[model samples]
Target: MAEQRMPLPPLLLDGAEYHADPIRRALSALAGDRAGRFAPGDLAAAMGSDYTMTVTPGRASVPAPADGTGGVYLVESAAPVTLAVTPPHATRDRIDRLVAYVVPAQAGGTPGAWYLAVREGEPAASPVPPAVGAALVLYDLWVHSAASGRPIELSDMRLSGGQQMLAGGTLAGAERPATAPAGTVWTSTTTRQSWAYSGTAWRLLGVQDDTLASHALSGSRAWGPGVNEQAVDNLTFGPGRNGGLIELSAGVVHLSRPGRWALSMQAFSDDGTPGSSKVWLDWPGGPWLTRDLCDTRMRGGGFAGAGVLHQPISWTGVVTSDQALNAITIRGAFTPSTGGNRPSYMVWLYVDYLGR
Candidate 1:
């Protein structure tokens, strides 16, 4: 007789063979028809053995079956089992089942407030909320003109507090230093003579003659309104009977005494003739004689004298026939010489008051 062989229990075959294959596979088979489920021992074995299983709740294991079919069955007197399986890659459709949900609060009761923070070895987090009542700051982004290739263009422009604004037509309050216009010209006149404020110090522009003789001439002589009076006198002497004699005297005699004088003369031969004798005298007399009178035969043999004199002479007391005398002579004589025979003689005698 063959030993009676009870039919192998289905659990004893493939489905019930818990110790035959990996614990995760047997438990996964037993969690029948659920989206995700897990057993404790299976979860620990999967994590410890492979380190690739995901043991998070509601992540990878299926739920327990309601009909007790194809689920992890705890046999009588057997420790409960846990099974772990690799979770599927996260998908938009399964995100709610796999991931936790977190809702963020609004900032200042307004939307659109957002920030980001990055950390090492971890996922980045959102930034903190901004202060209340704060204004939004913005940067100045310059935009150039496409046609002109410039940032700005205008006839007049202005700036205030780092911001530029356009001016309407005119600049009313703008203050600037005075400036000369283009092509501006200035003119003035200058003179060579010295000038004074009262117009009195300016001299004549051309040559000026200030001499007394030049002032006395009849031409257009410019004269200042000041007094211009001049006087001169002259007297002269020569060799006469008494060795030396006062030959000629001429001057501008004033009433009491003359102030201005000038005279000239020449003499030749011992005879006193009109053309043979010439004489002149000025105040402060002397033998102011020129030319050789010793050789009387030469046509030019005569004494010549010419000079200018300024002296004071008396002219009030007595008069004489000789015009050279200033006054009457108390004692004097005139001896006339014979032609080419005797020596000539000239006498000048007069007396007058020597006035101041």
Candidate 2:
């Protein structure tokens, strides 16, 4: 979808009528553009004079920082305000509260009434500050019961506004943000993995680890054991062999992510015969009902029998579909000039994710 631009105010003509509402609308449009460009959070002040909280004997104060200077969120505290800390009770060890700048509801239909608010916490051994709803938090304070006139370490607890931050829990438990701007990132706390918003949905981030699955071969299966010999077969990963990243059935692979990927297969046998084999993703229906050979091997002169041939072949392509998952099948063909028994040993399949 194309991004919509905010409309600018029209140029004034000579002897034209001017209205206050048009000026206000222009200013609002500008502010809205700023809000869209930058994330909502605290902005730094000049000369290190910011909304840092300072604690006194019985009070906590913030220095007078100019309004519209500390943050791009278009809300600020114009004057310095101090709140009195509650006297600690003997039963409770500490009292906690959160200091924040809150934008309040308009009075008598007038707008832009922002003020400082203290979200108070209940007295407890280790008191936690209450949630600062619709407020930009500045500091979290904990007052001790026993210590009077004690030095309180005040750390600037404001969030930076320059970049979009990540938020999520486990892969299964955590719910992704219902709506996020494209390129936004979210980390799964349980898996320690990250996902990115792809304008439409959350896509897993980074190069995914290779998924490896092997299929054990049974008795002797010759590549070509007859005259005018040509054999075609599907290389498969055994049931339950999927690495949880992908799903496999026979030779078809099911991928959930929509992006570029690198897929590979290795078919090895003990019998080394004078034969040639080609592997590819099934496309244009060739001899094996598959075209576009990814890799091919020709074994001309080798001892026939008793060794593993670990020649891995790979193919790289982009997979996209209207459906959530994509399905691709792999097929291979072997042609031998003379009749030779090439007993199947094992088939190893790999799918490596590149990225979106």
Candidate 3:
């Protein structure tokens, strides 16, 4: 039953079942069936599978199939040869199942010991491929116009689920394809970045801003605005006093997203009397006010004199979504050291993303 089921040609049974004619017919018939065609198993061999004919470095050949559709090869070569073939024009094509491989030689690095499959003819080369200790396989299954032999499509199931994107060489040396079909996905064997080909070029996925922003302000406004203290008036601000994130008019810092921030402020008692300066922050609906429970000041005044002293105060915390940062505000205040001396201060704010 096994022999009967084996794709042995009737003529081959009379001859040798291992002959090229039988195997070629078997492969053609198998592919033909898979491709919606009929392949005559007895057609006379029109091409030689044995390496009797020498195919040189820059040569090509289209082994004549019994029905001019497809055929097999028993190549004896040192390098891997590129095989290509075109299918007859129809509404569709399905010859992609065709495959190719190199048989390992017991004694490596010798010519005329490997099989190079044939198709639409050649323009491919493999120069002294490194000695493969084990049997290796390579395949070329291009379905082209039966009439013009033009490429229509391709896929690589080995990578990203049959993507038309492919690179040549080892993973370290592989280069991205020059062009790819729409929706084709490629994972760089070199960088391991998953790039999706969007017809124009490869685009990275899940990328976020990796920039850090900070702003610092110092000096004094002759007429103080209000304490809790400075009102960031505008949407955009000079990096000196209010980084663009601070709103000068409403004293609010509107951030598009929640982030970790470092808020610090300093006040100096420059006059010959003791004075105090303070800073604090509040969200529209926050977990807590950013200041000591008893004291809401960023800087406590020092003993005023020729030795002017500046006090520094700071706070660190995570801004959460519920406490929409856009609704938050920062304020500062200054108290006179003596009779009519004005208070002076400085502040710095830094925001950074933590990927949360």
Candidate 4:
């Protein structure tokens, strides 16, 4: 359908003759058909044409409104608000979409209102051909980036077509189909799961679950009795095989997002009078807190088993911080009951990441 018009209101004011309702002229371009509205600039850039859009009492609005029979339809506003939209079917897609937004009204001017309309559906082909572009949204959620149009089909949530799907006879017997095609898949006799074919072979259309079950170890480092030190360990700890997120030198870790993080450590120390090892939280430029890990038991008898002692310690704590762009430093120190002995070495530091 084309743009349609509504009856114009009489140009009169409070008990006297006057100009048109300032609201009506502001939205003069809108009508029942060609219900679409746009600013002069958007139309020029997108379609190389000059156009203005207006609305009726049911369409004029202040805050942008959603399209439908419901919601607050724009009847009037305090200002003349402008809106812009790209022509529908600008790219090759099964359906076209119309989008609009309201611009803030001009300062120190008569307040105006506009029609709020958003649309998406299969419509008549456009008079103008699709524009050349790098990417275009095909269906509601489908996307294509190449200029060359190729069919990459998604079969029952599994993707196939020019790429990877295959068919190995998995059904009952000779009566069963031989190969799974591009867009259609068949159930397997073995696993009984649906499979689709690409250029290569048939692949499964299913979900998978991967668990983080293994323990990743960090290389050990030593600490003295009276001086502050970093319990250096292998920094190979992060998402999958990418490596860890924490720094071994500065002991700083730049977080991807803020959430709950748990750190657990099992350590061993050399012979000494034996004392507690302290672990501190360093948010770098933020707050600092310490956790005292107990010395547990002291065992010795070296120098042919004379003064040799070993103390086992465990440290665990939870940290909650803000999202990205924040950094953390974990600091540690060992306090010996007596001086002159290298009392500690961090053996293992296990980290667990959890969401809030």
Distance (Å) between predicted and true CA of 186, model 3? 27
lDDT of 2 by residue, 1-356 (tens): 99976464364756656643355445434443222212223332211123234332211112112322222233434344455555555555453444434232222333444455545567686677676544445555555554454433333454323222222222333555675655567765433446676557666555333333222211122443443322223444455443434444554555655666676766565555567655445534222224544556676455645233556667666766332254555545555546565445345566666656
By TM-score, the best candidate is 2
The per-residue C-alpha lDDT of model 3 at residue 269 equals 40
lDDT for position 299 in model 2: 60
Error of 2 at 159 (Å): 36
| TM-score, one value per model | 0.11, 0.32, 0.31, 0.31
Best-fitting candidate, scored by lDDT? 2
lDDT of 3 by residue, 66-113 (tens): 333344322323332334334334433333322223332332455223
Error of 1 at 102 (Å): 99
Comparing 1 and 2 on lDDT, the stronger one: 2
Cα displacement (angstroms), candidate 4, residue 267, comes to: 1.4
Decide which is better by lDDT, 2 or 4. 2
Model 1 poorest 10 in a row by lDDT: 212-221
Overall lDDT per candidate, in order of appearance: 0.22, 0.46, 0.38, 0.35
Model 2 scores worst on lDDT over the 10 consecutive residues at 56-65
